[model samples]
Target: MIANPSDVRNLLESHYFLFAFLSSLGTLQIAVTGSGIRALWLTPYRRVTRWLGFVCIITGVLFFFGQPLFVDGPWAAGSVQADSTTRAWGVASWDELAGARNVNDIHGGLDGVDQAIWFSLAAIIAFSVSVVFGALSIKANTKELRVDAKLDDDDIDGLAGLVHRSYFSNLPISVRNFRLEARKFWRDGVRSADRWSLIKIISGGSNQ
Candidate 1:
């Protein structure tokens, strides 16, 4: 992530600043949830928020790592400017330069990285936005349970522990809880589908 002063300055001056800011926000959300500190979360639905964070990180990593395919950098194909038109127009030929850029075109000049950077940058933005949506959509627990009512289980689920205790004591349990919640969500969806099918079948039989 380290860069020269000039690159940093350029990034700040360009739209890339928004990209970087969004990515940083996403990374920060992941850090907060992964560390098991729920106090800072916008909503009380821990499972939904954590899942959103998980998806965000996974997407960001994939897009960032897949830059070689989407990005037409110096190492990309047709980067050497093999012909006069390519050298002059930075495209394969004058026809390509005159025509709209094709979806398959990869020799888009020195600004290739600019075109491709949006994929990863968008992923970064998606990550941050997903968690916020999760927070907004899920309902918070209505009952005001005591923070340390059940220190081991409740404290892990509750927002009582400070940073150190939250990290060391609750992280493992938090991850496990997320897994359980995922399984439950999947099962619930399947069950609902089955019930809908049964209802449809009964209605069809009565109509016949």
Candidate 2:
């Protein structure tokens, strides 16, 4: 339950809190399942997870904006002029309880509605931006992994050479010479048949 809901700030805060909780759950679900969208079972619904994330954000915004309208209406508030029947049941209407205690609070000095509206907009914008970036990252990573998986030994060696040139360009000559000598020594040691066989065994039989 929320305390001081008569204050629109508290009410909006409660709505925002609930939105955060539900959005977190939605994000977690997307994280767990988004990568598997290409799998056999999930391939059919590949776009669904992405759309669901958008829906969660939009729903949260709607809930935030709709609360004020609903709370002010007479049907939602019930009658202040209750008759004998209403009292006979011992049930209190919304007006009998709080009577819209701060009826003008939402429109008054603090700019509470404006603050909540802006906050909800910011939250939605942040969520949308994060989702877009996350999706792009997932796509880039997946493409990179696929390219790496398709690379042969020559391609890998060429990449290693490129890396060595770029990374060691500013190194001292002595340091580069020492690294080359150490690599040569290791390669020479591993060239022995017995040592090579042992290395193959240790490396799960992969000669590379």
Candidate 3:
């Protein structure tokens, strides 16, 4: 695959569109994960955390495969030469080009391929680090929520208010008001004396 530098460059360049597509996919994945996290009453906390972790894994894999084209190095540096060679090869006979060999041919005469390989490895390492940090965050939040469950009503209410404010802090005034109404409904449910209502409210509030 690396027999010719031009061939390697052309192959990588051809994947430019693929790289863009994967990046778009990653962005969509993140947006969906964020939306899921915001719907606290609708989804369980552990499920959200697990889903986020899964999304990160998919994003990381895509990034590892797709980010090399954007990385600054030999891939960008050799573009002009690759383009010229591609045009020249179009006019030249295949046999002539195939027979041509350089005395300095080493490691299949493709230097950029080595750099891309290393960059891909670096991307994987970065992805691994992100997953580790994400997992730790999930663990810490899980522990905190567990502790919060045992707190008194006042403390729990205070914590709930804090969470509500933080979650809606970035929204517009109108949207925030709407979310607050929903919050009130959830709170009222939590305070209900009916057995079924209490169970449902507790499940929703605790999930958040």
Using lDDT as the measure, the top candidate is: 1
- Choose 1 or 3, whichever is better by TM-score: 1
| Cα lDDT tens digits for candidate 3, 67-173 | 43344322232232353333222222323332222212241332556446644654454444434443444344554544654322332232233232222321344
Candidate 3 residue pairs in clash (backbone atoms < 3 Å): none
TM-score of each: 0.31, 0.29, 0.24
Model 3, 122: alpha-carbon shift in Å? 11
Tell me the spans in candidate 1 whose CA falls farther than 4 Å from its real position.
Answer: 1-22, 34-36, 65-76, 80-139, 142-208
Note the residue pairs that clash in candidate 1.
none
Candidate 2: list runs displaced more than 4 Å: 1-8, 16-46, 61-76, 79-103, 106-125, 128-145, 148-208
Q: What does candidate 2's lDDT look like per residue over 1-208, in tens digits?
A: 1123234445545665556644653564365345542211111243665566667656766654444445532213343243212211122243454432232333221256654665566557555454444444344445443565432232222223221122122124435666777898788865755445866779787555
Q: Which residue runs of candidate 3 sit more than 4 Å off their true CA positions?
A: 1-7, 10-29, 36-130, 147-208
Q: Judge candidate 2 at residue 198 and give its lDDT.
A: 64
Tens-place lDDT digits, model 1, residues 45-75: 5566566555655665554334334433222
Rate residue 122 of model 2 by lDDT. 53
Best by TM-score: 1
lDDT of 2: 0.43
